[model samples]
Target: CVNCGKLKADLNDTSFADKVKHARDPKTRMSVVWNYCKTKTICETDAIEETDPDMPDEAAPVKKGHGGCGHVQPQIRKEGLKLFLQYKKT
Candidate 1:
């Protein structure tokens, strides 16, 4: 990913499900997922558990975050036979 290095979308995530549903082929699907993942800067956060009406005793499984870092993506730059990673501010 461009920012976060982890996959924030899972099967239970609607965002991921939507991408999967519209995929034409496996290769294209992977590309689509990658493109989307690369554009996202923030990672997913854990959601609060909710109890279902049908199963009052058991709360629905809470979604876990991808635990991605909040740092900016660095770019490689070279000048005068020197190489360095340049991090741009948002």
Candidate 2:
């Protein structure tokens, strides 16, 4: 994840977007985003649109995906006062 430096989770209006909307400052917004992203188990992937080879202009609607590093995500834990990453089989 650090190597690619990409967010593990994709943004959505249901949860992440709604929480960020009420954040009053950048710091608060950052935490809000981080909290939502940290729990994701896998990295987001790009959606592939299926197009008709015969009809070049015809295509399907966008699928669910994004441009993110396809890497396993680690869970962040707060143990007492120390913060660490917990890795397990994903």
Candidate 3:
């Protein structure tokens, strides 16, 4: 969820809106937005370290990719839908 946190931070910054406005085209703008909003996977070691020490490894929610992060997947799907709509508009 680090990337999602960063995206929220970037979105909270007013400068991000200005940058989006200055983007040359819809695709470029979407690219900039997507860069901030993409899903990132936590490595196994980091996931383990961040998890509760008392929790068993089997019980700990650690998966190799975006599967572990439910929050990001919906954001990504929403973005993809938006991009498709944008493309359709043009």
Instruction: Provide the overall lDDT of each model, using Cα atoms, as 2-decimal numbers.
Output: 0.65, 0.71, 0.48
Clashing pairs in 2: none
Off by over 4 Å in 3: 1-12, 39-90
Worst 10 residues of 1 by lDDT: 39-48
When sorted by TM-score, best at the front, the candidate numbers are: 2, 1, 3
Model 3 TM-score, all chains together:
0.31
Q: Across residues 1-90, which tens digit of lDDT does each residue of candidate 1 receive? A: 346555745556677878888998999899878776665544654554556679756455545655555555556578989988766677
lDDT of 3 by residue, 1-90 (tens): 433342332333468677887998999998877675453333112133476778878987554432233333222225644732111111
Q: 65, model 3: CA deviation in Å?
A: 30
Model 2, runs deviating above 4 Å: 12-14, 54-65, 76-86
Off by over 4 Å in 1: 1-5, 8-12, 22-24, 44-61, 75-86
lDDT of 2 at 87: 72
Candidate 3 pairs with clashing backbones: none
- The candidate 2 region of ten consecutive residues with least summed lDDT is 56-65
* Candidate 3 or 2, higher TM-score: 2
